[model samples]
Target: MTIEHAVPADQAADLVRQLYRAFLARDPGDGEVAVHIANMQHDGAMAAVSDIIYSQEALSVRAHAEPARPSLPEGMLAISRADIAEVVAYALEAARHDAPSAYEVELRVDDVGRGTPLAVVLRDALQPPQLPQESVEDDASINRTIEIMYRMALGRMPGPADLENWRGAAGNGGRLSNVVFGIGESAEAKLIRGAFDVVPGIKVQLAFEIVLGRGAAAAEVDHFRRMVDKQGSDISPLVWQLFADEARRRLLPPQHANDPHLAYIFGSRGAVTLADWRTGKKAVAKTAIKHDVLGFESVVRLRPAEDCVVSILTSLYRGGAFIRSFLENMTSQTIFRTHCELIIIDANSPENERAVIEEFCRDFPNIVYKRMDARVGIYEAWNIAAEMAKGRYLTNANVDDIRRNDSFEIQAALLDTLDFVDVAYQDVLYCFEPRLPFEEIAKRDFRSDLPVVSRYNLMEFNSPHNAPMWRAALHRDVGPFNQSLQSAADFEFWLRCRAAGKIFYKVNEAHAAYFVNPDGMSTRPDTRGAVEAYAVSRELYRKIVSPMLVISDEEFLARVDEIDAAPLREGRRYDIVQSALLALGTRREGVVA
Candidate 1:
């Protein structure tokens, strides 16, 4: 390889040893260099250089060595080792920069061995500070230009001996650009540039170099250039279309024609309010569940059908972190793939969640994605998704929540077996760490704190837990969730259902895990907002359900102490309508208790 032959073997060995010591802060193990040298002969010297500088040992040492450093610079990718390694590997393999010198590699040790983002380092490597343009006939002027280039490129002034060596080259009629090019292409510079995450423009540039085997002509396709710019980091779709053997027209899988359950699939992106969404207005983006690709190794079997038993409504806002968990959890359901429909409404998240959603939408045929032009409340988004639901049953899906793989099967079977039950809620396991995969979480110690929804328990707290599956017919009878309240909207809706004489069945199993993150709305340190919302919802509940009770609101309120002292029962049912009214007093401004 060019890198292996760039310098004499003895000089290259010194550079590699310096790399191991500086990057990993340790001496190489016995025979490690020999192994890397073998790899160098097979792949290239840079590959061996990369193997040492970006190895797991290097990353771990750097991370622990500087725990007190300021957190990663804002706007950079989270310092995931895998992500960094992948991007750096690709850049190292594809970039055509000159091989670096041993001295330059030693000089860059601090920058490369710290928490500095690889992107920043790579950007610097690709575009180093320019050398000063000056007449090179005189020794004094050449010395000035060489010293400046050394300082800017290597972050230090040139030593006396180095100055003499560079000056001799300059005295021999070497151009300033040529004199400084070595410092810019030094080992340090190449290593830094290799770790940078490739931008869209660079991706296009790399594709030209690797696939087309030539630099892109200015007259090249403008559409592809625009596509790269728009796609940002993920250029695979564009790459496949532009360079792969596959036909460009078939780049995306075929979408369903006139899908009855979806509002829009093939249309321009735009915004719609919750009301507009309910009215069948065009969504900013959408994809049908039945027309997309199937997920590999999914436990759920494919059951292709036009109809489904349950429609899962997921309202996403700032949920980019939970997308992977959400998809994995949803697709792991024991029911056949087509037995349920997943409806996701994106609330104009600032994060580019739509890209991930679109990519997965192509894999999971049950995912029906819709994006709102603007942010909306969770309830508002749920209502919008509910409007487009085409199943017999409906459930709101929290993107960050976890459930057993058979949780859906259990709940759906409950509803199917008990035709009288309009709503089915199961015990929920509340835990600090709910981000673990469902299988792992299922093995955890489960605390079944949620009880059968007695009108009493629902009054005291949210008994249905967020994972309840309810009949879609309830929405037709009782209407969509209340948009007025934020925290207590679900509670208010459940009370409204109870007042409308809808029966709720509680499954005794704790298959659903409710994440109790401190930052969560209900779990935050200051719960005044939730308290006030609860008060308002209780007042609304009193107004809706008080007339349906035989006892007055005050009489029902009098039994608060009695109910608090009652013995806890796992299977006990509390059905008295008087229990629906909150014992806590309501205020004009809404009370905390």
Candidate 2:
């Protein structure tokens, strides 16, 4: 038993290409082929081929080879058991006798032999005596059949390009069966068929599972069935409607008046104290302040106190032109120059950029510049700036983003009127291009509708980060932003505020323009940030929310897992929080029995 020698180096490329096509159902790219060929020369042909076959891409293709199908048979007329039983009985009677009454047909199908073709039997029993057959090979008949096949397989009519492609494929001596089979085997066809194959009952159950993480109640199932019957054979729309309704229902804050959890968490009725361990005392701690913070200078000062402070964190040397724009926006603010103080926290910017900051500070009396000895991350810079703030209220200002002229005034006014509102946030207008005129960009408003902030809503969704103003006391009460978190520092702080029983008020007007930079930290996909945000949310849930609800630690953690598994967008960390809150509410009725 001698092992075969490895294939020659030149032929290994061809073998690699062949394996790629065999396993992945596509030709290998030039680069892929070259890499694999090199591997084959170093290892062996068999080893190279095995590696390609077991690769993630190849395994994904293989997994999709046999797409999932509905358990129900394709082209079945009746879905309900009674209807199916009647059709079966009629088919059996037709197979047994040449001419049978409807009553006899219903009675005889149960007695038919096991191996008979029910389709043929049903066709004979259902149809009248056959007339002279028309030629279905004609253009009109073929076109009509093609359209029907497209609908049955894809759940919709084919597009012009797809229709033409199919027509060309079938034009070369094609039969109707060949066209139908080709369409039926497609991935789109399989998915559509599978979706429709699910009975109305199962669809209702799936809707409940997807939205609320539970099975539908008997009443809910009955209601969905009624909806399905009204909509006829197309139950897909009904399923979507059910899912939407359930999502809205779950998102609506539970009747908080009687919710013991809300009372415990928010201390709405003074049911819990700030010193209680259950009221997030364990989770709230001051982030360790870095003593390495060396360079500190107030380049400008104003004697008459300001009501608000605009904290801007920037690495002026790295931020480039955006830093200038940030300074211009701060100076141009309608009320900020008079009513607010601008604090620029520079993380040891270059000498040239430091000169630029000094020039701005020299020109503006209200603008103050502070440089750190060492470069601290954004979260730390935020914390340091907050500590240096002199105003009664503080709001974060971004280098590349713009705030409306009256943003500070409006938020300050709102806070003044509402003493209970610890923080005030406004809607933001998102602009893709930073160069765009603020007036033109301000037309688009991204409103934060979570008006009343609670642990439940705050955990579920995050309000706009740079668009909010908080009372200085709230910051003092909540401590500083968690320096440990890289991306979700703002979110963690917001959670802390909510945990500390601080109420957030929503100012309906668009007060800021959030510029969307492809390279920006928040917009780009950060796996670590997402994972960290998730962990933060879970800990918040355990320390703040779980204590309020009648849920065990094990059950609460399990609910967090289910929420984490949901198909949530990575950037929308609040959605994950909301989902966890929804899950906790759903399980509050009973444990996972």
Candidate 3:
């Protein structure tokens, strides 16, 4: 293999330029080409895509002469950074094994003639130890590098897509500026950290461009950041003081008042899916979809991929006897902040509802109150709360759902830790009454093991308790409540979301407790509740039950007999062991056979 070496000049330059152009042109979802550029050592003898090669077979373009001028496939242009690393690795090995060591690697492009000046010195570079991208997870350093490449390919620094760049953006919030972001593989991560790396000079230029560009309204800026959570958050009384101070100083820029994206809605018959997303809002299927424009029946979709995970839209409507306890718990957990807006969506007791909500909001400036004329079911109120939500995620605060301190805070923290986990439940108990001593609660009711039941078990077993903070964007994926069902709307939603992705994630630590209130809408099942629960449970079992839950008809029916014979009172509570034993019967074959 007599190899001929060539100069690292215009040909190398052209090759590099063409590669860059090709990469930017196709623009793979992860901004793969851009990353390769950033990772390559510029000062050295050779330039290469950072981590494009892993093996010869994986390469889209085989560099070895044995393959004789195989043109790199256009697909390679959109390759992921991880795959690219592998491809490049193979190329390096091939370069080393060549008998001549250094070779004149001529460029051959179908679009551009072969010899149009693209060649480079095949440097004898020793490859560095490679690491799997997944192993690193959301490594800060790597993400920042990714941000830079994404911006670089888009031809900007501190890219306009950066939420902060829209400081004073007006006229529908620089929608044009933001969409430039692609639904790339790591889309969620990109949205989480809005900071992008612009070639240093470009970053400075863009910053100045933003400051001088048409200033955005203060409300718009807050709304925009609130949408993506790019700037991070500080939900202290100080944040409110900042708001009030800014308002007073007239430093508050005008917010685009007419933008109608007030709420995001995702409907579900069973559970909330996006409530505990790590990055942007998680997706809930069946009840939501991705549309070119805003959706109907649900809240309008935003950067739904990352920005709109619905949690607590507004902390305004908190009501009932649980108010003091709720606030005290919220306080003890340190989540009761000035930015919260608690609204009372319970329409059952209108007098107590309005009065309690109003008093609570008034007592705490952070809270507010509102109501629907006709009593909307749990899902609908969820929809309403989503629409009314002002923060990152809108949590479902059932009239009877109890909150242990850190319910919101812990959900937030756990969500941040686990990317795959969207809906989370702590080691909390559920039943008509939580007032019973903790020791009296059943282990199963306590959710000791947060199992990922097959779609069927979720509908019947109830994995994610009704009370959870949700990312607003799941509205675009799942949906608000399924008004069609009286009791199982959340189950359907949770099941559907699990179908799309992972389901319930057990936090294993109790931050809140849920007391089943007989008065709770889901519990006040009329005949409709029975029919709806059965129908939904059937569907969930059919669609989502796993191997463990699946049993032959004979065995399954036998188990059902055990449950039916167990004389379990459907909706009752007890602190007395005698009642439990009596109701459950002697701990013998009677309950099972």
Candidate 4:
């Protein structure tokens, strides 16, 4: 076929600009456009196109395109000058080849001396007589194959275990390409592909996924895209810091945990050993570590420790969606720093709660983060956090729930002053969305009504508030919350406390906010699961209180029915409960009302 030649300078410039954008993901500078235009006029369009595409810049861009090495801080290069030169030279040589050649070109550290030019080293390495006919599975070839797979799939170098595992797989008749595909197809590796996302929000979400094992919240996505637009900051450092934080938390798997390229990430971030981490001694190194590793620039500064007074226990499961709001509620509290400590027990949550939690932990000193290796029931997580509580008073904090800014202060003050009250339960403001401020939500709809929850009202239903502050000694008195119950554990515990003569006082104000989420355990579309869980809890409660009860099981349940049928006292309303019932009824009728 005959080729048409470019004639006009404008056409040539347009072609060059398109090539720059297509190959380099950027517009060509004025000077670059002029040079390429001149080249095209003199050498023709095809030659110009070849030169632009085969240029060192284009080659480097393509070589590092997928899973781009996360940006480094302070313009620090991920590799040494010599290593970078070698890589560029290798890429240049590989791209220059128009067709397959008999000679194989490769560069090894042992082939070049210090200060030797990369061109000279490659020239020597490419010599057919000097090149060794190494088998594809040889040590050098396998190492190279492993490195290529890791760089492509994980955006980092393979660790010792990674190398060993891949080598074993290759030796066991596994093809090197298959190993590459295997690594590339893994869930972890899939997250690393965020570098290629054109949408900033998708990129941010992918970064969160890789670093935190969960997608980014909507607010986080918006915040990061703004950073890219206003500040012109690269998201790589954010992703890198996330990785560093994950490593600091020891949340990474063994392969990544032991990666030598990522070793500096842990070293700089004040990472502690497993034993120290378990004992709540994270962030031992307070100062920022300035040393640059392959993927990280500098370590994040961590907040100093705070004195514990009120232990806020949060059990996280599928709570990734609520992390931002939950942390805001806790940190915004007036006594958050002075009197409250948040102990988060993540029961192997399926979402990326750890990343969000650790990010907040850097600024909030009272956060205690712990991860469970396997999924556990909600009550089990609460029990775990309760035992880990260090404050004088402890309160159960659900990940999806929020309270007023002075909620902690109010609850703590009640417990601190009222020596007669062993447990203080406050009225709750119920809302559909916890993201909105409770005060704002109350203007449109509100629910705050809990009659004195004595042993009498307790038989009808668990009237004790969901988020209650009680003396830490009460845990010893009533023992930990019943781990056996799901939706009704708190109820059984309240019954236990009442039977043990523990006084429960109801605070006048609605300080706590309950988010009636449709997907929540108690508020899901199906009520059968919660009802069955309550059934189990009711049986257990009856057994625990039977010895001290004056009524039989039938009479107790009958009294509960009576309490349900009783009219509300003056100025008392269960707006939250009524709303829940309305939603439940609507769902049963196949309507969203």
Candidate 5:
């Protein structure tokens, strides 16, 4: 037999210390180093090192120091030191008495002296581990145990009053396990675990409603529920899966085949040709009345003596019920009523809708009503109304939307408080119904970074157009809303104002609610609107942005082409309209001006 020489004591001690630092993230103490050195000499170096690595202290430290191997679930609870020690103690006991053949017997230090083996210590400790024959249970002892368990599980101690109530409840023979389980399954526990109370079925329904803009079928809900269950009650991954599936469905050509609006816009069968657009544009242009030629006499009906004159402009169309609700919300303005005036420019609505506007004008004191001869677009009506506005600030109100009673008051105060702010806007909530029981579809908060409205960032994302109460002078300086652009006139106007070094401020609260009408002109897919917005963006880039930047016309055109090449959605076609604007703003450092 060949004999192998044992490692030197000093070398073994150094190796033990190195192992502690490597595995436990700390150097071993002098006593621990000495103990390992002795073990290394007696049990062989390899065996001693392996034992130290596998020891309870070393394993616990290693488990926390390194990322979990069989990766834990997203919200899994962390294993505590007490839990590790308990498990180690139980395993040692089981190996010594119950299953020595299954688990290897390694003697562990039970005390600081290292005199008693772990197995002997456990045997002595558990000698009389049985319920008392006298049945003399102390309520104080049970309460203390309950409090300790709560602290361990929930990471908080129960209030003194709450602890008394818990102790009273525990009088009915509730075990320690019962208390643990109850607290673990609480709503508070669920919050700590990062688990939502939403059911899998509701999640599937909401996913479809939000993403696909429709409700989920019974079969689809059932399929998603099964997926949620298979993934161990986690619905986020399944929600993402549904989003991918919906994206694929949206990409399919057949989905747009039946919808003539999308087909025409995308140049499919039954497409709206370039000649068709030109014919429509010419027909609208023939009856196009300029703001100056509107023939409405410039008259100031009721000029209030307030310092800040707020002109609330509303262009009424066919929506009678919405117009009434909007007027009611407007007239109910309490604080800023003395400082505000209502201007209604009727765009040839039906007799019934016109009746609603006339009734509102008669009821309200400072309201100015103007009836147009022909039905010009909303932007044209806005321009016509703005020309007649006698206020320092001007805000356009949608007839179908609802505003908070204090919205105008709040916005007016914000504008007065801030210096060099040309426009003030606030967050808005979107709801399906007009009443108190309306289902909120979305809430848009535009207060991420207030006051500092970067033109470059604004080019990327259009600020909430209807939310702002802009200074009337800005409209005069930048010119009225572009009459040629249909849907994106507001977008073009904002870019023009931004080009002239104007700033917009945000009010951090939702002071308005936008009613989402399914059949509304803005909601429905309008290819004409999309194309007009693109054209208007290009026009603004040439007239306003190009002159302000150092880039060549060819470079500017290339940037615009890149933005247009991006994927276009029906409602969000002008999403990338800001790319050219951003490019111009970036190169403005080398501007010729």
Candidate 6:
């Protein structure tokens, strides 16, 4: 077999990312198909499998293009049929070297059955191969099994083995936070958790909730796509209608059906006023525990100063309908009742929007509108709001969102802990303004799989649910949102919490309404340049990268992946993460020190 060493380990690691991304971005040929390599050569290092998928994503990513590896970019997939086996060996070499590396391997039948390649194998023979990640959340599926302990109390449940096939279908969330409802065959009651929390695919949660069984998953998807095509509307609406129709069909038939054992899966997507589940009703039994929201757990009030919120309100270039609803909902939350404040940065908004806000101020006296004439972005606007807040905590509200009545109550319960979270929020419903509903996104639990930008614990801060209520003091120690950073000032402030050694918690309740982009819904991390000042971030990075010198090659690869994600584009989770890892690896300054 010919040995090739054209690419360095780091670049090879990138290739691995692209490959893996391709796998995820597209549908597998069949569930049975596994992209096997010379696992025997690597001494059973199946870890290369992950590298292949990740590299595929990088190669497939393009400018202004839908992400997915449809056709390989130059050299990205130009693997010769012959080098396949060698690529597998290189994977082993990289693994043995304790670095993140990969190869475009092609294994011949004879090589797979025969002797091991020498020299390279002998050199690193003593080294132990790195294993797959063993994060705290690994036992998600098992943990979920425990959540339904009552079922087990009634019967003998084996373990993760019982859901092996299911475990394979939904990856991360299914594996960790895995829930097995006793619906139909294994029906459980009205226990709904955010399905999105379990998987990363835009629609994986849909797949997990809709059970035609894995075998029928593909057919069902095709059928839904066809319905959308016939409806002559965009995918997002089609997705919503499909869910609504399904909700009506399965969970709520026009007339009730015999589904006492039916496992109900709803979301925190739309606002859910949970209350007692009864028929005119008497109390239920201890055999089953019940939960429903009669009111909201959190309230998101747009407390922009007259200078800020007003400016945004009056900017009124195109989305006027959005503005009207925003104002209407402002005074409606059940918690605020009589009074609520509005903070605006004076010079921040367009003149006309400011005019409208001033008009609203007159209409409602409790509508306290404070303004800073100086031009500032979101962070400062929020600081202004916080300074003017009469309420104990501040929710730097999104301009487009409105809160349901009980919103504040649930969040208050969760945030009252000794360690207050930087912010707290639940998945909101994706609907137009006014009567918008919180959809399935609500029931999701983000404590696990928390993204890097939102993961904070002293020395670093993460932006939690966007519309969370924050203690005004956090702004004091965390400091005002840095004007240096434009869009990311709030995010950077969160990073500061980590610097100060603090952590954010989740309420597992959806409190507010957020308008999702019509095209699709997803968030982007801020690029270093987008921040008004990269100097501080860079300083943080520098301190981070230095001590990281001692980290192993594999860790270095992971760190690099995080840094490359530095672009503040949509899906920039990768960059922020790499930067953080670099910081962690290098922080010879142990106190964030």
TM-score of each: 0.41, 0.43, 0.36, 0.40, 0.41, 0.40
Structure candidate 5, residue pairs in collision: 459-578
Per-residue lDDT of 95 in model 3: 39
Candidate 6: regions farther than 4 A off: 1-34, 37-321, 338-340, 346-348, 354-364, 371-375, 417-422, 432-465, 517-593
Q: Which residue pairs clash in candidate 4?
A: none
- The CA lDDT at 75 in model 1 is 24
Q: Which ten residues in a row have the lowest lDDT in candidate 1?
A: 259-268
lDDT of 3 by residue, 366-466 (tens): 55455556655556666676677666656666544455544565566555556566676655544334343223333223333445545334543556654
- Residue 445 in model 1: lDDT: 37
lDDT of 4: 0.58
TM-score-wise, the better of 3 and 5 is 5
Cα misplacement distance, residue 425 of candidate 3 (Å): 1.7
Error of 4 at 282 (Å): 47
**Candidate 2 per-residue lDDT over residues 214-321, each given as its tens digit:** 434333453344334322234444444445445544576743323211212121223322233233424545343221111134222223443544443332325665
Model 5 misplacement above 4 A: 1-308, 435-452, 542-593
**Candidate 4, 1-593: lDDT as tens digits:** 01113347765665566456545657789999999777766654544665776677876787686312211111112222323233333333443433221112212332333445433443343333344554566877988867865764566898899889888988897777677677767787767655453444445555665666643433344344432221112354346545655564464354332321111111022322323322332333334322121113323211233568789888888888889888988899877877678999888888888898889999987899999999998888888888888888888888788787777776776666667988888666555544876555444324455677664456444556478888889888878876865676776677678778788888776667776666777655443433444454434433333321222223333444443432322111233334445655665688543
Q: How high is the lDDT of residue 332 in model 5?
A: 82
Worst 10 residues of 6 by lDDT: 100-109
**C-alpha lDDT of residue 580 in model 4:** 45
Q: Please report how far candidate 5 places residue 148 from its true position, in Å.
A: 84
lDDT of 5 at 517: 56
**Candidate 6 at 56: error in angstroms?**
24
